[model samples]
Target: MIKFNYPDGSHCYRALHTAHAVFRNDDGKLIARAEKADRTGMYEFEITGFELLSTGIVYD
Candidate 1:
């Protein structure tokens, strides 16, 4: 599991040994992306659009 701080100063935790995706609907436009694996065998990303929603890592 990965632990970090959000942009709002809140502590966040997520599972890193898996794949995940994110989506945003801004002004009726849909934007989507996925987390990429790095050399450290961990997936990393700066997740956004999670201000009011609680999110968790997804494994496939």
Candidate 2:
């Protein structure tokens, strides 16, 4: 099990099951990748083309 916190105070968890397949990138390099969650629970996903929100500061 792998866990991490996002910038929006949400948590994300991923189970490393097995390498589904190996695909080649644009440079023809083999890359090992696995399938993500099955979308059964609440998960935080970071959008690529979005601006960050300024929600004050988070102090741990």
Candidate 3:
């Protein structure tokens, strides 16, 4: 699971392993993008509009 929080306190995620996060809406359309931060536990998120709403998601 890809997990990280944006600077604005919003969060985005995906189920695939990649260098960047590609956020999609409920309709599965592209909405936002962010790259993994050089620092751990953070993401440089821009183009907001996505947030993970599911509960019980954990980092592997």
Best by TM-score: 3
The TM-score obtained by model 2 is 0.29
- lDDT tens digits, residues 6-39, model 3? 5476665654443355566676555444444443
lDDT of 2 by residue, 1-60 (tens): 434344466644345443243345576544444454664443223321222233464433
With a 3 Å backbone cut-off (N, CA, C), the pairs that clash in candidate 1 are none
User: Between which residue pairs do clashes occur in model 2?
Assistant: none
Report how far residue 33 has shifted in candidate 1, in Å.
7.6
User: lDDT per residue, candidate 1, 1-60, as tens digits?
Assistant: 544444455655545534354444555432323344453443444443332223574622
Name the lDDT of candidate 2.
0.40
| Candidate closer to the true structure by TM-score (higher is better), 1 or 3 | 3
Per-candidate Cα lDDT values, in order, are 0.42, 0.40, 0.49
When 1 and 3 are scored with lDDT, the better candidate is 3
Q: Of the candidates shown, which would achieve the greatest lDDT relative to the real structure?
A: 3
Candidate 3 residue runs with Cα over 4 Å from true position: 20-60
Give the Cα error of residue 50 in candidate 3, in Å. Answer: 15
